[model samples]
Target: MTDFIKKLEKEFDTQIIRSNKHIWENYYDVDNDGNITTLYLDEIDLRDIDILLPIAHSLVNLAVLDCNIRTLITLKSFTRLEVLSLRQNNLYGSPLEHLSYLKKLKKLDLRGTNLTDTSSLGTLNSLEMLFIGGNDHLDEIKGLEDLKSLYHLDVSNSCINSIENICANENIRILNLKGTNLKKITHLEKFPNLESLNLDGTLVEKIEGLETSKNLKELFISTWRIKRIEGLENLTKLEVLDLYLNEISKIEGLDNLTNLKWLSLNSNKIAKVENLENLTNLELLLLEANEPITYFDTAFFHNLVSECYIYMRDMIDIEEIQAAAPKNVKINYDDDYRWPTSLYRAPREVFE
Candidate 1:
């Protein structure tokens, strides 16, 4: 470590030439080598390449800055960087022009940044996890036509009313769109590897085109206007389905989701739960704030014993439920027996 630090300092001195009061914003002593291993400055403006020119070949792994007035970043040559977070700053013209050089980047959080015209971002082929959730008015982000290595994308709060830009990224596993208004989505047939999707807040009237995915696991749509569950039967690998705060009265549409382990329907108009029988793998059912529960048959939900949550307003059907309940089933609204999400999944032995 000590020898490496000396090498880093010697490399830094030969590369960077300070300017504008020589105000070093920050520095790090990786191995106490009487020299700075990492350096940061305020006036290292990206508008000119002088600041970025020196650090590109140095051993810095992360670079984060705010070009409060700059229109672009001067980081076309920094290829070895691992992480970069440049958010909430202004990039009037565009900063993602030469981003393709960052092929080794793993996580890039660009939330709240004005990347409105970042048509250049489509070239960052190595970006694995990206967060553009805060750019609420970005109607379209063209050019990401070949980012096959991207895995996680968080566009939750963005105005990305469309998914047309990143449709072919087969490697994307997680997608979060928690607070965007999406009336309809097309071309989901290309996302075969998507695992988790969060559409919690939006006006999605229906989910008609999600059959192509084979490995989807978790889905969150708690605060949407959707009334029914559709386009999910083909996802035999689905495990968690959170549909809280909707108007779905009955579980009539989930007969084929036998692999689901956790299902929540709290704050809905549901009264009859007879349709829950086919969800044999289900262990948790959150039904609080629902209407009259006279149609609930314990036999239908008896298979959920190892972990379950069936709460509503009414007397307990302990006798009828006990007879059909699985021996491992445990229920509790008042105390310690309540099961966690981790326990909602049936054990390996149970599945065996």
Candidate 2:
């Protein structure tokens, strides 16, 4: 072992292995008595440290790597790293230049980093999960089309204006594009394996692009400019649907989703719960902060099963509605508080 690596081992209280012939090919601490599982180094400014090449080469078998180092210049040696997190760093240059070499990386989190270009990430074919949110300068995600193994991708709160490059990766299951400038999603039919999609806080005025997404289970289009619920009749396998904070005045075109469990239409202009009679599998329904439901129908409660709970505005009489509801169903009325109360009267045997 060299004198520099020997000093670092004693300083960090960890073992460092060094090769005499191949000095660059060395490993970190091995499992002695089950003391080390991963190498976690966060909030450390690596710019002041000089011998970073030896320290980077030592993390060969590292499974979980978390480093907030100011400069990511020496991360090329961590080839065996599986999970890497470099969030909240001061990386201004091309920090992702060496990450493409980590072939075993599965989860990567670069949230709040200064990355503007992501062209090097296309080489990481084994990456399954990636989070690049809060990057204000990232206006385009152009090089992620080859990530066929990716399943979950969160690019929320970024400046992504177009997603034309992301339509080719059909294996993605969960895609979150909240708080972007996406006005239209043109390629919904390409992702047949997509299960969950979030387009909240975008400029989407219509719901028109989902024609072949029959396997989708969860969808969130809240805070959009949609006034009607159209183009969702093909998603028969949907379970959770969130259309909150929109201009939807009616709840229509959801009768096909019989497997739906949770439906949120709160903070809309809906005046009644009319078309939800077929959602017998629905467990939770949120309709609070909307127009007052003037007509209370007992048939709505009769269609829902005993485990179903409906949350509505506080203007309705809870006791009167509970008397008319089915024996198994529960109705919770909001208390008009700033934080809405969950006060409801259910049979004591239901909780027991």
Candidate 3:
């Protein structure tokens, strides 16, 4: 190593030793040519990044998570950086203007920051995965169509109410909008290649506007006020569905999902275990906490193509389940909680 790099290494080691952190070598990686390749300083309070500016050209992956960073001007020098994470920092007010200089940057994680604007990110054409969730002040995203190479994007738990800006990015594959202010979903036809979508903790009352997600395999709509399982007729390729903690009273609108493998309807208002006879390819089924549905239709077990796991509660009859279930099917009563407190009720027992 050169004298300058040797002196820089000594200073970095002293800082880590004084703070009682792990060995300095563990936080950074160097190439055989004495160039720094990776640096992980997550949760560290080091604020001065200019001290390492000499090796910016060699650094490829860098993470300074929760480091109280307030600026991004120094990071513009890292021209060779491909992945950068400044998650959970104090960065605010369009501080990402310098990031557009990183032409090679592909992935960025800016979660839980105090940013007010992110319009500058539209210039990152090479970006593939971008995470900007948990910024309450960020309400709108601009210039999404400019990111032709972008695929995975996350803006969950923010103030975003509309996604009109990203209606042109056809390459997007996975999108997460969980816990946002969105009450309805539109422009889904723009993402014909989407595979997974998370709308949990939103204000959407019904399942609609998903007619074009034909390739979707996984869908999550938990912890919301969705009343019925409709608008899923076009998702014939769906394999996993999680509707936990909703107001669904019936298990309809799933007949087209013949490829479903894992399904969870726990904590809903379901009153009947019907309409699932078509899901013969299911490998795991969860139906716990629906106290109203006191019985299981034994006919549903006969359609299983292979062994399946069924999550049940104590209120259901164990004798009926054991007799109705096929030899390969398995029953699970691991909900661990009893329902309807009564003085004459006896202690609970597990049936193997």
lDDT for each of the candidates? 0.62, 0.69, 0.75
* TM-score winner: 3
Candidate 2: residue 341 Cα off by (Å):
12
Best by lDDT: 3
In candidate 3 the C-alpha lDDT for residue 327 amounts to 84
- Steric clash pairs (candidate 3): none
Give lDDT tens digits, candidate 2, residues 126-236.
888888878889877767779888888888889876666454377888878888888987776667888988888888888878888899998888764889998988888
Clashes of each: 5, 0, 0
The global Cα lDDT (0 to 1) of model 1 is: 0.62
Query: By TM-score, how accurate is candidate 1?
Result: 0.72
* Shift of residue 80 alpha carbon in model 3, Å: 2.0
Q: Which segments of model 1 are wrong by more than 4 Å?
A: 1-79, 165-168, 301-306, 309-327, 335-352
lDDT of 1 by residue, 136-213 (tens): 566665555477787777776777676665443667788777777566766666677888887777667676677776
Each candidate's root-mean-square deviation in Å?
Answer: 8.6, 8.9, 8.2
